[model samples]
Target: GDDAKAAQRVVRQWLAKKGITAPHLVMENGSGLSRAERVSAREMAGMLQAAWRSPYSAEFISSMPIAGTDGTMRKRLKTTAMRGEAHIKTGTLNTVRAIAGYSRDINGNTWAVVAILNDKAPFGASSVLDQVLLDLYRQPKLPETASVL
Candidate 1:
């Protein structure tokens, strides 16, 4: 218990150094199952983006579950165009569902995506989240006159 607490303290310090405020994150314990543990979707997306640009990006990306291929995502997005184009981590609770990670679009651009639903009746929220990824994967090309910058 002492060791776990110490690890949590270290993690909190590191998060603080990264400028993640208390409103964005609250770690009750190492286990994500804690009701008090919280992180906003924006913060999760930011973290994913940071990881994507990190020196250890390859290792970090490889550790995530590939959509419709492995881990918790094995059966998800199986028939979609995004099946194998995403590396994501998923979380679930009785009233909460979330997904956060990088997804590659048909145009070869990578995008960070995060969706979290905290509802009293969050039934069918997974499909909604899946659609969000699919939409990103199938995004239409912007016109030449339109600047993405």
Candidate 2:
């Protein structure tokens, strides 16, 4: 998480001055691993959109895991179309499955989606439904450095 206390706190504070309220902030560890935290779909997208237009967009994008390359997302999602075209971050646990990232279509329209599923939400017959969200960004090609993650 690029909070105001980060080295690039100036960038984070700039967004705050713009009336952007990052409420519902349960991210004490920065990483979304604790079972005590949750965020709305809308709020997650707002952060993604902000990162895209922010000065730290490149930094944020570069930190993501490359599909079939590195990080947790590399193992499960080895799809042919997603191998190189997609890059993302992944997380999993007995009570949680989450993925969040961006995907740029051929038309150059970058669309970001963050989906979260909780087992206690009563989504279906099974109460322990943990579906992993593998967010991937589709681009023309993966850069040389990212070819290996």
Give me the candidate number with maximum lDDT. 1
Q: Give per-model TM-scores.
A: 0.83, 0.61
Which residue pairs of candidate 2 clash?
103-137
- For residues 13-73, what per-residue lDDT tens digits would candidate 1 score against the true structure? 7767766544667777768899988888877766676677679999998999999999999
Per-residue lDDT tens digits for candidate 2, residues 33-118, read 66665677656667777777778888898799765567765654465444544446655656555556765444445566556655
Name model 1 segments beyond 4 Å from true.
Answer: 1-8, 16-22, 140-149
Model 1, 72: alpha-carbon shift in Å?
Answer: 1.3
Clashing pairs in 1: none
Clashes of each: 0, 1
Error of 1 at 31 (Å): 1.6
Error of 2 at 13 (Å): 6.5
Supply the TM-score for candidate 2: 0.61
Clashes of 2: 1
